[model samples]
Structures are given as structure tokens and as C-alpha cells.
Target: MHRSLLAGTFLLLFTTAASLAAAGSSTGLDDEIEGESRPAPSSQIPLPQEGDKPEAENGEPPEGNVTRPDTREETPIPDVLYDISALPEPVQRMRKLLMDAARSGDIENLRPLIGTGANRTQMALGGLEGDPIEFLREISGDDEGQEILAILLEVLEAGFVHLDEGTERELYVWPYFFSVPLEELTPAQKVELFKLVTAGDYEEMRTFGAYIFYRTAITPDGEWLFFVAGD
Candidate 1:
């Protein structure tokens, strides 16, 4: 009986201690949850009224007010520009004949012009040479001639000519004769030729310095003289 009473007493003490410990743990957990649930000090702060607020430092809109719109104005872009095409039959034919003659060094196209007169022959023959200034003189003389010549010289002085040699006779004319012959030019000579061909601060080789290429060359064959003009 005594042992049973002691055992019961011990059991009751243990239960009481366990209940107290569980209550303490529950209280601690509740305190932690309450502390976490409380609002942050910064978040609890009140926003100032518009009228009461201080002026912005930079005098700019607030960060919240700035936003990019879904649409914006765009600049209109231009299309690739090409030169006015030379289309009139006479001009076209003349241009074609001139190009062909320049390429082949053949004056067959100037046959009709030869019958016109000495002046016409001189002018037309000048066109046969690769000088754009001379061509302008043939086409339109005087002030216009001077203006075009100036423009031509400017372009020649600065611009590099990229001649495309192809089966196309008209285009091939440019490459066929526009360049100084490789056999006639040393490496340094070739560089000099390129420099004169592509001269200045501007685009084309219209400058006063390009006349050397337009001069004539008498081939060793007395029967066949080559015009140094185009080449």
C-alpha cells in the first residue's frame, strides 16, 4: 500500500510538471506569433498630403509618376536613292555608243557626228575621251559646262572608282579602259595611279590634276594609236 501511494504521488508530480512545461511553450509561441503579426514601424508611417509635402530636389516628377507609354512617335526613313535614269532614245543611244566606243576604243558611234562638222567632230570626239568635263562640253557648253566640270573634277579628286568588268558591254566599258594597264605600271606607279584616280577631300576625280590620264599615247605600232584618256 505504501509503495503504491508513493508511485501515484510521483506520477501526479510528473504530469503537473509536463502540463506546466507545455503551457510555457504555448505562451512563448503565442508571444512570438503576436510579435511577428505586429505592423513594421516604417509601414505604419503615414504619407504626407500633396500640399504639405516638400518640393522635389530635382524639380522632377516622383518615381511613382514616371512611366513609359505603350506607343511613341517614330521618324520617317527615306528609301534608297538612285540617280535619274537616262532614258531618252537619243541620249540613251549616245550614252550607249559613247560607252561602247570608250571600252573598245572604237569610234563607230561617232560616224553620224563626223558628218556634222569639224566643231561637232571635235566636241563629239572629246566625248569619246573619258573626260566627263569634255563630255559636258559636248552635251552642254558655257556656264553649265563650267559648273559640271567643277563638279566632275571634285568627284574625281576624292572618289575611288570601282569598275566592274563583266560580260555586260556597257558596264564593262568602265573596267575595260578606266584603269591604267598593269604591264605599263610598276607597284609604286599603280599606287600613284590609284591616288590620282581617287584624289581629294571630295568624291569624283574632277580636279585639275586628272588631265595626265586623259592625254594621248602613241603606241609603238604606227598603225594603232591608243588614247591615254580613258586608261
Candidate 2:
């Protein structure tokens, strides 16, 4: 009877120990699964917003993302005058005299207005060799100088510019192109210029970097300063 009782006690002890071990193992497995499924903490870092774009080292907006504005300055065009009635009395008188002489078609009529030594109208940049009238005739495309006379009339009829106002060098210059940049001329202005020069002549002047063609200048006091060509 004592042996049977001891056997029953051993069996009960083994079964209780086995149950406790299985419960402990199940609790450990549950803890492992919970650790893997739990979400991360709310204190973690966040991603950048759409407006938070990065800049260049020079403080400019990044190249591909922005377009910079053009800050270069443009050249100003000069004012062109077409009316002779707006000129001073002396200037108007001289212009009328030149027009009359040019219309006469007699190159000699220009002589008296051209005046004598020292006050004579300048016909060339470098001084003329002999008589001014004869020199004009020589340079004329035809024998009678009609072409030159026509040119003179055409030059006076074109638009003019008044420069050096209030100064000793003040004068009225013909064919306003003399004071304007070739590159800056408008299409209409270019057409007006074509009336005075051939397309080839315009291209040559552009290459030379200035309007080196025939241009006339008269002083504010009615003196015909020059009717010449060249730089």
C-alpha cells in the first residue's frame, strides 16, 4: 500500500511540472509576437515638404527649377526731325538758298553761297585742291554735275538732327542716319535709308561700323560747315 501511494505522488509531481513548463513557453512566444507587430514611436523624423526646395551655393534658385531674367540694358534711339519750318530763321534762309541753287541745276549758282576763302563751304574732309565748283563737277558721276546736284537736293530733303544744342559746335545734320546706329534702325527707317543708299552700300557701311557716306552739316548760325563723306 505504501509503494502504490509513493507511485501516485511521483506521477502527480511529473504532470504538474510538465504543465508549468508548457505555460511558461506559451507566454514567451506571445511576448515575441507582440514585439514584432507593435508600431514605431511617434517621435521619429519626418519627410520634407513640397515647398522646401534646396538652393544653390550662390544663393540663387537651382538651375533647372527656375529661369533668371535678362538684366542687360538696351541702346536708345535718337529723335529724327523732318520739318524745316521748325528751324531758326537763319537756318531756314540758308536751306532755302541751297534748295534754290540745287534746283537751278547750275552748279555755278552754288559759288556765291559757297563764299570766298576761309568761309567757303567745306566740300571734302581734307581740303579741296582747286576751285570748289570745278572739284564738285569732277566728282560728279556725269559731265554737267546734274547727278551731284540731285544728290545734294535729296540729302537736304531727308530727315535731319539737331546736335550739340546750346554749345559752340551746335549744328543741323542731314539724313539723320549719321547720328543713328545701323543695328538700331527700324524697318521703316531702313527703307528711308535705302532711298539714299543701295543695299550693298548699307552692308558696306555696316561692316565699316558707321555711316561713312555723304552727309551735310550746317551751323546753328547758318554757316554751311560741311557737305562731305568719310569717317
TM-score of every candidate relative to the true structure: 0.21, 0.65
Query: How do the residues 50-128 of candidate 2 rate in per-residue lDDT, one tens digit apiece?
Result: 4322222222222221111111246344479998899988888888888888999998988777764444565532223
* Alpha-carbon lDDT, every model: 0.24, 0.55
* lDDT string, candidate 1, 1-231, tens digits: 122222222222112222222332222211111111211001011112243211132211122210111112352211211121422344334434433443443333334422221112221111122332223332222323332232223222221221222311111111111333334435654444443333231122233212223221111111111111210
lDDT of 1 at 186: 50
In angstroms, the error of model 2 at 150 is 0.8
Pick the TM-score winner.
2
Model 1, poorest ten-residue lDDT window?
Answer: 38-47
lDDT of 1 at 135: 35
